[model samples]
Target: MCRNFVILLFFHICGCKELFDFRDKNKGSNCDVVFLSDSVKNGTITSPLYPSPYPARTICRYEFQGRGKERVQTIFQEFNLYHPRDDNRECDNQDTLIAFVQIEGRMEKIDTFCGSTLPRPVMSNGPRLKLEFHAVYGSRYSRGFKATFSFIQNFGIKVGVQLPDYPCAFVFNSNETRSGHFYSPNYPGFYPRDTECYYFFHGNQGEKIHLHFNYFDVEGVFPCEAKSASDYVEFSNFVSQDRKYERHCGQLGEFDIESDRRFFRVTFKSNDRLDGTGFNATYQFLDKVESFTTRSELTNETAVLKDIDGFITILFFLMIKLIR
Candidate 1:
């Protein structure tokens, strides 16, 4: 009976897929449904009459499914939707493209896109992602959107038993390995709002953590103040107010930082407003002695050892001659 119920549910979802067609009405059928998964790794989705003004009262749904430890990544090639005309315009109540991700069995809105401007890439927090295109009834319509979707493996490890309070918290330990890399949540994509992610790095005794950012493009201005309400990334040995470095935001070139202590912490905070393509960094666990040692000092020590060895040899030969 249980197996029969599961089968019924599977077909029920398949039947629902027929309700939304990605092609224009004249195309006759929903012949192509891009359901991304492990085997069917990647595909594309487009609005009905994409590149052309979509018909009024149109709705479409695209589903992405990934296997364990995999997440969906979507990048739009073109986007031109009916966006709000307010001074502080946004995607609200217009022809909008929205993405929702499933987390712990519940669906949550991750992002909403409109306007002619192309959007930053997006990645899901879990294995399932759904994209909905809604075009409201109106006399005027805009060219819709087209995007490519793929299932990518998630590299971040959550810090918790079963499910953590903060799903984005992760730990990098020297005992696990000497070096590794990590990225902002949905990195190379616009991160979500109201999110605070923490990355903890712990080095073995006599070691320290060194970090270098490869790419950084978070939203905000210079001297990103924590109290000023902007998205920023910060690095420190402590999690409190006595931080070792300033908050980083906006765009940055490649840079390097080393932790003063064995434990290094990185925090990324985003507000409810703007977001941009986040960052990716590489980290290494360096021994304190190796990190502080200089090449010139090592060369001088080698010269001193050679001189001592020559003096000892001469003294031994003279003592042998006197004995003879």
Candidate 2:
């Protein structure tokens, strides 16, 4: 029954080919304020008056475009947007950082964040991404944000973007990379908020998977327990009910989990409030126990046991008749 559930869920949310059909979209129209473009495979962007207080009543917009069907991924190296109300600390209230994706001609707002914590990495659904910063009237207590962006190249039919090496930040999915060496969006650097990355690992038949983390850090400083509202990494198996998942946060250095079947899955989720530098991990296939017998041999053994039981029953009946 558990196996059936996994198979059902797997087919329910998958399709690789035709990942993006860049439609009749107005090219880079999401920037409503002062429009700017920095076309680079790897680069950085900072708020208007970064390191100093950002200007009041200002809106700055930027766009990162990848070649053809390629997509953009970004990391928030430093974030210190002003809070209009320190007590309430609303990101949309004063200075804010927002990310948008233009997919099939429609612009969708992907994330919005403010305050001190570095959020998780952000990945675009398509080839282009729009980034905006809005600062309201005052910059009294503010230090602007700094962000980095990179273009991700597509390799083959699976249709997912390839993740760069770690110690940096970005939203990363590992379904297509079966090699099992995947990292949190920005490793060594702090991750972003309102982020969720999924990884699916598959092993050879008759083999299991070994997964371990080299480093992990996430936000749990503010309590929002009812919704499991902490920045954490969750694990599960997609091929079986070996659902012993591991969730880690806040400077956990070394942790590991194993898979019961050929398929393993992992997820990293963060809240909009606070976060830390994310995690890094590796996975490898391991051979199963060698004392196993094939199905035909096992069936033959069962048949032999049944035959012996029948012979004993007949002998008992004969003895009873003789006694009578």
The C-alpha lDDT values of all candidates are 0.71, 0.59
Q: Per-residue lDDT for 235-272 in model 1, tens only? A: 88875644558888989988787888788888888876
Global Cα lDDT for candidate 1? 0.71
Tens digits of per-residue lDDT for model 2, 1-324: 332221111111111111111112221111232112233466677775467766666666766655654556677778887674666544656567788766447776766877777876676655677877777653646777887776754311122243454222232233344444667654554554455666666566877767777776776533324265578776677622233664666677576677777767677677655556677777666667733344566899999999999999999999999999
Q: List ranges where model 1 is wrong by over 4 Å.
A: 1-11, 14-18, 21-120, 123-165, 239-241, 292-324
| Model 2 residue 271 distance off true place after TM-score fit, in angstroms | 19
Model 2: how far is 313 from its true place, Å?
38
Which one wins on TM-score?
A: 1
> Which residue pairs in candidate 1 have backbone atoms (N, alpha carbon, C) closer than 3 angstroms, thus clashing?
none
Please identify model 2 stretches exceeding 4 Å from their true place: 1-39, 87-90, 154-207, 211-282, 290-324
Q: State which candidate has the highest lDDT.
A: 1
lDDT assessment of candidate 2: 0.59
